[model samples]
Target: MLVVQPRSRTVVVLAAGEGKRMKSDLPKVLHPLLGRTLVGHVLAAASAAAAEQTLVVVGHRAEQVTAHLSEIAPAALPVLQAEQHGTGHAVRLAMAAAPDATGTVVVLNGDVPLLRPETVAELIAAHESAGAAATVLTAEVADPTGLGRIVRDAVGGLERIVEERDASTEQRRIREINAGIYAFDAVRLRDALGKLTTDNDQGEEYLTDAVGLLAAAGAPVGVHVADDVTETLGCNDRVELARLRRLLADRVNEGWMRAGVSILDPATTWIDVTVDVGRDAVIDQNTQLRGATTVGAGASVGPDVTLIDTSVGPAATVLRSHAVRARVGAGASVGPYAYLRPDADLAERAKVGTFVEVKNSQLGAGAKVPHLSYVGDATIGARANIGAATIFVNYDGVRKSRTTVGEAAFVGCDSSLIAPVEIGAGAYVGAGSAVTKDVPPGALAVTRASQRVVEGWVQSRRAGTPAAEAARRAAADGEAAHHHDASGTVPGDTATD
Candidate 1:
């Protein structure tokens, strides 16, 4: 079977709108949706559609937008639309930056992050196949308020597009509205844009007028109705931004689900676009995986976990923990409440148990920091046991130091291993000990004070003639009653006095 390839295309993204309705100082296109900014998502879709070149037109916060684009999509050209005239003016500026070519050019809105790559491909294909001068993406939305309405001829042939302000009562009732996305033959688009005039009610050049111009000039215009209306939704305010974010999150979670990952509750599972989850991984409710995180196969994450830029190996379980830029090897167990900071690495089968926090540390295979411990700037060898309430005191007044525990070493409960220290292999540190110096192999280190006996101290303090005699009589009575009870004698059967 022969697969027809899509024609070479260039994409022009209009991102210059001030978006004053958003009431934010930041440019609307720079607002975040899912993990990437709004324009970032548009650029991603453009890249996915295999555009030969992409140009972004910026005006509001142009410097910030250009800087971010350089970091995320450096290949895209940025053109400045100094005046906020209209969409047509923005596209015209972008077209000037785009190379002169005969292939199709796609115009997209930067705030429409939910637009899919396949839809763009479809529009291009339809434009090329129909040999139309231009193709406009349209949608049948429930409310066409504040949108341009698409008017058709009697035989349902392509006609002109009218903006809402200029539409008649009947045209305003038309449900099919222009979706603010278009594909056009490069030469024809340039010609139509040249003929655009600011004669509309708003005295602004409308891109929709270009479609009318092309139709009037005996050039065939095509209309492609998007299957999902939400795909054409653009964010103009905070509410729409949040709606788009939720939609994008749902799309990401659905993709993971289809890849054999089990998401117990997708509504509460928020995975970013950059996250990857292997097959058979079980992500419980309220788990948020963000920023280049990867979850391996058979791993169990959450009921409440947030992993940022962290890697979890196969079969590892991270329960109710927060990890950032950390690594957990296969079979490792972390949490019911643990924090793993940057540079923390736990080897296979290692355990970082409840209330434990690890930072810039490494725990070898079979190592255990079972509970209530802080292991920072330290290295624990295989089979080393870190008992409850143990702390590696790694920071002095000026700087931080490291503590190292050799293989099979046992750090007793309530012990503090002061930093710039080491414990040799198989060494034992007694409970409640604070060791500031190194311990030799197979040795026992104890720093606690020795036992001290104070004989008859309480008796000497409480002794008095009548009071001490009454206490002695009471003790004798208590002992006699205990002996009677042990012999199964009833209290009432014994003499009271």
Candidate 2:
């Protein structure tokens, strides 16, 4: 159901928790799940609610966390809490930032990234309709032992909330738990925040205590128990983070699997936040598609490959390859150990064989790099045959260089095209040649070392040998003489044989 739209609602994200358990210099909210920040989910939830603005409350490692959030461009303000007092104290710091606020203020947890927009809207609507001073978002947990329990009044109205540390044995029986999310009348929230005291057991001002104070003052305090606890799960540790991510992955994978993409192992395949898999695309086990990577329709990604910031066109096959910042066109095949670095482009039907590395190069349609080769800073034209072990010697002592091969050019096995070199269309580079200059069309460039032999070398050794050894050496010398004479060729001319 569409909830009542508020005149204005400012979402206050509480990311100030020390999160000491994370054990990292980076803020807890910065931990990535499938290539997106944990706090991004909270911002996304607020956006889904059509929030007028979102405000993030930051404290520990606030600067680093805020810097990262700046990249996402959330529709919210950032409220800094300098002191590590408490949750209430954290939200209180936001008062000066949103002073004279009269509409709804939806308080959210920055580490809880699984929130849904619908639930947030409901929280705001519940507060507005009832004109409540404060409304807490609650969920029924099977075991609400560690969480704060929502203590409802006899008439099932909001009475007070007690933290587990301060709760009595009787109060602990309440299965309904506080999710730490709230929507309050901005004016009343501002007023109540000032009156709050740090009299709790932890010597911290508890936000839940305000509910009791509001209720006792005859002001309305509301409650909105969300249907699913999973949406409210807060990630403070690695285990919960993984659990929440698996939950999220299941949702994302199921949607794609239903949409005709094939995931061989849902448990093993991981996809990033912005990746898109086309129809009938098959993603095998342990494959990770991250950072805006797109697999086109009918394309097959590895049972074990990592693709980052790359695009694979339809029917392309990338098997066991690490492709980063590259583009693989339609029907291209990248191999079991191919590495395509930044700016590499494999055009339609191009083949990159095992152990080959291409960096900042463009392989045109039907071009083949078969086996151990390095093509860096080069351009290869259509139907070019890159024989085994070919290396585009692109880097000199100071600056990197480029090599260009034209259409139908053949680079023979073990050949090196030293850059600033170009092979004209239909040109050939003979085996084992290192071509440093351009080769004209239809020409073959052969760079071979001279061959020389010392005649009667074995006969010379016979002078120091015994009689039998000399005889044995004579037989081997006859065979060696039969195999060669001059020009490194035997004198068995076909008709002269």
Candidate 3:
């Protein structure tokens, strides 16, 4: 017996709108929400739904959108729409790119960042089950303002979709609104799109008209009602975009919490969809974890921290710090106020204490840089200790260099280890020293002027002042004490030594 294989799926994203309401030089679809561009979220859902191919229609600063797509979704092809026609025209351009598309063709609006993959999957299931020529995703909203209303027939079948501008008072009263997501039979969609014309109130080719056209021609049209109305929300401006962000953040945080991650304050903590949190991790308040960041199991991050493209190993603790493109090994601790720039790597059991800044440096296991210090372009070996106020002077006038601290080295407080130098294993660097040359193994390196005493200088230089008066009285008391000692008697002549 022979078995048949499933049909292929194609996703078409309509992103050509100029989005004048956004009021920014960047393309509307390129605007970021929850650490991802609006269109990027839609593409993610499409990919999750297992689309064999994805086509994004771009216009109005197409170059910028295409460039961003290359970085985020390289596999998804982009097709340019030279003119701002309408949703129908945008889909037409996408179809032109995939003229041989078969099976299910899903259409998604680029601005609906809250759309979920399960909803798209449900829409496809409903369309295939009903053998529908076209199916529109619908939701029952509290207020249907600025949206298209779903009109039903006597038997509760989809009759038509009426835009807000074209809807009558009775049609506007309908609570079921169109979500601008659809699944269609490829052949039927191609025919219906070719039949569309600019006859609507906006004098543009409206995609909703295809639903009415198919229903009128006796083609089976269906409706898939989404369980959650929030999934259908779209943004036209920054205010709506922020609302979407809050909703998305809540969703993301809840998922992590359910998976055993502890979020102290969900309201103040923002986790991007791209971020991964291992089980049993703790995320404190006022923290934003963004852009491919990963936290290993048993990690503790922040009461106030932001990590971007960074990795926190298991059992590590990062507090009140900011890190980007860095890595912290297991059992390491970073900051009450630390900044780890790109290429900063900490080995296991390492410590980067308060007010420290590290850039392009590597700390070996058990190495520590405590208190106020700056370590740049340096490598610290295992068991080495860097004292307070120590700075690795890595850059000179015309060039930058690196400093290396050997294993078990001890750097004293208030020291500056100039780059192009090396402190050998077991070497000791004295306090207030400025090391300019390499030190041999087990040797001591100290650079400072010899001590010099300048007694009574303040008394002679600042006469008739507080210092001079205090010095004069101290000298008189010393002279009297000396006489009393010689006589072996007290000042009051009561007792002898």
Candidate 4:
């Protein structure tokens, strides 16, 4: 589908915050939620928003953040903010990396991970339509304790924004708080960025100072109140991360539940943005579906399972399994503890038992990989009974090989079907066997030595046991007379004969 968006805008992602409250060496933007870094979420949203250019500014752990972002968004331009600076200074560094162009420029905080592309598009549209030099995204907060307040003119237009410490008593009473998100005309934003000075109490260049500068120059400054306050929250510490995590997850989970998917416990269920579950799919508590995972209709996922980049077909049941980049077909049943690695495929009605690990293999329809087995680089045939403790040994250290078990074959317990071998249809592999060669159809492949006994061993070992004592007692009591038959002379007849 062709997505219509303002791709003319250049996005400056402010990711250079030291996040001292986070109390970690890692920049706060690199912190993960679910399985993705906080900055990753914003970058993905920006990409989805169709920004022509996305610039990332890195300060704390500059090289690490740059490397991580390059891996995530290859097209992103990383600008170095070598020293700890204020948001405006960090954004100014990123603007230097932007190419010379006149278009809408949007500023986004990397720590605000839950923003929607449509919301960002709206912010840009407001900035363009108002013909403003700058537009600040603001929202009403119940407790505006640590946030900046948007001070408006008499006509309710954005005059200037005051930081908490710099705000007067009149400004403190204002419920509308600055969300630290802004969009501006490319030229005007640059003009204001150059004029920003470190004249505040902290001697840090405050972007809120630019709102006043633009207004004093007779350039229009617009105030935009965001409809969703939770989306604009910036994480500062672990406590705020936890709070924002709950908020973001609750919103995402609620949308999924409203779309016909059943999330049994919203508080315990975690899902990523790329995950797609079909109607009638039920996600149990503590289940995490991440990274482009798709669950089919009527499928039941775990109370404690994680699936990454996996596809589950209709009517499948996966419990307590960690399936990564795998596929489970319709009617399949996976384990209470199964591990299906990349390239694993379970055909219709296939069973992967507890503690089984299947990788780079295909289990055919009705095939069962029962408890405690590892089937790797193999193809299991239809209706096969893979006995307990059976494994397909497919590796010879350097190179891996394939093992194919034919239809309806029964591999006995504790057997190993070494790779480059096959079990023909209806074959029987004996217990404790290790078949390194092919077994013909309907044949029994017994790979163990025939039974043998050492002579007089039983007599040597049974001399002092309870059975020996009972035998001696019976012999002394005339056991022959004691062996009387039941009321007939059958014993005597047999003995005499």
Candidate 5:
């Protein structure tokens, strides 16, 4: 089959509206939906369309939006609208910013976060195929209130779009509403925009009027109805924004599931669009994978786990943990309640057990930091065991330092390894020890105080207390046992003989 690709063109994104209905200090386009801002999603779609360039028209919070664009899409230029005259005026300013723009110019609204790149490409293909001067994307919605209605000619050809206020009683019943996304012949769009007038009640130049002008001039105006109606929906308020977020979440989760990722409870599993889940990965209930996180194949994450910008290796199991900017190597096991902070790295077969918090540390392959331990600014060698209640004392009053445990080292429970110290290979750190100096290979380090006891102190100091009475009773029982042994009358011994 012979294939044809659409000619390269410039995309104009209108984002200058104040969005009064949204009632937000931030621009509507800057509102976050999934993992990105509303305009960010649109810019992604526009970039995926392979346009020669993209121009964003900014007015409300223009500086903030421009700064965001620099971060998300440095290649796209921002054009200042200066004043909000409406969509037509925004597009006009965008065209002025890109005077050399040619071929098809795709226009998109910044608030439609669910708009897909394939849909934009389809619009362009239909426009080019029909050789139309302009093509408007439309959708057949169940309720079209407050939206521009698409009016068709008697023969079902393109006519014009009528806003709700200007629409007649009969036109009000039309289910097909203009999506406000368009693909136009760049030259013709420029000409039509030049003739737009601020003659309406709002005294603003309307982009819909340009379509009527093109149709009246005998230029073929085309319509491409969107297959997925929800994609055409734009955010106007917090309520609509929430609806869009859910829709986008469903879309993202469904895509991952169909690709062999097992979402055990999709309702409770929130996966960002930027997250990647490998095949055979199981995401359990209440799991949130955000930012650039990636789950390897055969990984099992959650019952309740949130990972941001973290990577889970293949066959790793992360149970009820929160990790940020961390890495779990293959076959690693983390948590029923672990906190893996930034730069925490657990190598293969490593175990970060219950109540362990690791930060800026690395656990070598087969290393285990198990139960109620804080391993920070440290590196544990392969096969090393960090016992329960161990603390890697990495910070002094002035600065932070690191502690290192060599291969096969054993750190006993209740031990604190003071920073700037090391436990060598085959070394043993005794229980209750506070290690301040490095130990040689195969050596034992115990810094706990020497054993000492004061007998009968409890009886003498608290004669009337329960503890004193218990101690006296224990002493009397011991004397009676000694008397019985001296008399060769041990209880239960004669019967056994």
Candidate 6:
């Protein structure tokens, strides 16, 4: 068991390659994997290992990479590799910029996002215990094609690393491959890097050359084989990027499942690495929790939901909703179909029901906007009820205003509350009304056209030629029947006589 102090180590991430195979203008290291850039994940691993300082070498699209690093990991120092050379050149630039020059230096590839921090720690531990000038992280993959092979001595010590193009027939048969990660003694690594040459087949200074150089100088070079070969996988194109994203997503979901979060369908649920979910929260199928979302205990989300930077309080239920930068309080209920935009906050036991869209508004405790409504830039007080098809018209042509519904206010169906108006506490708004003015407390507000009745209108329109003739015939028949009855004669019986 070997331990390396965090303060005695520096990490150098090689990210200067121009990933031309990706067929896009964005730098390969900037390509996103599972909601985070490729290099961002590598930086996270370095941080997790508690390195004293991490240096990132940037070349292609240096400005973009540097800008992103500032946002995510500002503590990390960014060094520019002005030349688009090999990995060796990138590491040299990073090492030059690193503050702890006498400490151990661990070099990692930025495109390998799945490499675990624990593995990095293990590599450093091996390097320290063996007292080796260089320790390479190796993996035994099924396929050795297009990868550098690790050549070991007869005594099973790492002798040298040979790239696929330079390897002999027998050397290519070796299954163990270099994973492009190394832990090196700072002083010895600097010496080897100084003597590196571009005389190889590729005519580029190779990092693997340093490993051989250290070995040739009678310095012990150790090899640490990775347990999981997939961790060594690197993204070169869009296809590989997708593969890595899926693998990382699976890893994140499995961790949550083990921590008491119920994911009904792991395959259909996508959660970002930055998301936090409390125990007993059930995430249903087709849910994507992205960008710093936090779900409290006993919360039920999805069946079809996408929440970005949203917070769900304990015991809240959000179903079939899309929310961004919203907050649903404890015991609140939202959606079978709802959209909650930025700054929309729902208080405890509040309900935003089907077909409702809330933006930049607050729904107080026990308030209900049940269906077919849009509440924007407004506030609904406690116990307020906004009826179906109601809309708070908060936007005029040039500017946006707000509407306030006081506590216990009742807004009727199909009504519009024009902006800059307030409905007082316990106020009643009639159905089909378009309210434009504020109403006093406990007052009834109705702004609809008065109704006017037209008496005998149907009869006047029906007094036509055919209608009058029919009425005259009916009157004659009735009089004849009355005469027969007064004479005590049955009209139908008189025919028999």
Best by TM-score: 5
Candidate 4 whole-model C-alpha lDDT, 0 to 1: 0.86
Question: lDDT for every model?
Answer: 0.91, 0.86, 0.92, 0.86, 0.92, 0.91
- Tens digit per residue, CA lDDT, model 3, 99-210: 8889889999999999987777778888887899999999999999999999999999999999999999999999999999999888888888899999778888888988
Candidate 3 regions with alpha-carbon error over 4 angstroms:
1-6, 462-497
- Residue 86 miss distance in model 4 (angstroms): 1.9
For candidate 4, write residues 1-497 as lDDT tens digits: 22444547788888887889999878899988865789998887666446788888888888899899878898888888888668889878877887574688788888888776767777777777778889999999888987899888888887898898888888898889988888888888788989998888778988888778999898988887788888788899999999988887898899988999999999999998778899999999999999879999999999899999999999999999999999999999999999999999999999999999999999899999879998999888999988889888988999999998889999998999898999999999999999999999899999988899785454477998887677677676655555554345545376548
Q: Rank the candidates by TM-score, best first.
A: 5, 3, 1, 6, 4, 2
Encode model 6's per-residue lDDT on 360-393: one tens digit a residue: 9999999999999999999999999999999999
- Of candidate 3, the 10-residue stretch with the lowest lDDT total is 1-10
Question: Can you give the TM-score per candidate against the true fold?
Answer: 0.90, 0.88, 0.94, 0.89, 0.95, 0.90
lDDT of 5 at 343: 99
- Check candidate 2 and list the clashing pairs: 54-76
Candidate 5 yields a Cα-based lDDT of 0.92
RMSD of each: 4.5, 5.5, 3.4, 4.4, 2.1, 6.6
Q: Top model by lDDT, which number?
A: 5
Per-residue CA lDDT of candidate 5, range 1-497, in tens?
A: 11237576899998888889999899999998778999999988776557889999999889999999999999999999888998889899999889998999999999999998888878888888999999999999999999999999989987888888888999999999999899999999999999999887678889999999999898999999999999899999999999999999999999999999999999888888899999999999999999999999999999999999999999999999999999999999999999999999999999999999999999999999989999999999999999999999999989999999999999999999999998999899999999999999899998889999999899889889999999999999999999999998887886559
Question: Candidate 1 — what's its lDDT?
Answer: 0.91
Candidate 6 local distance difference test against the native: 0.91
Please, what are the lDDT tens digits per residue for candidate 2 over residues 319-412? 9999999999999999899999999999999999999999999999999998999999999999999999999999888999899999999999
- The residue-by-residue lDDT of candidate 1 on 213-307, one tens digit each, is 99988899999999889889998899878888888888889999999999999999999898889999999999999988999999999999999
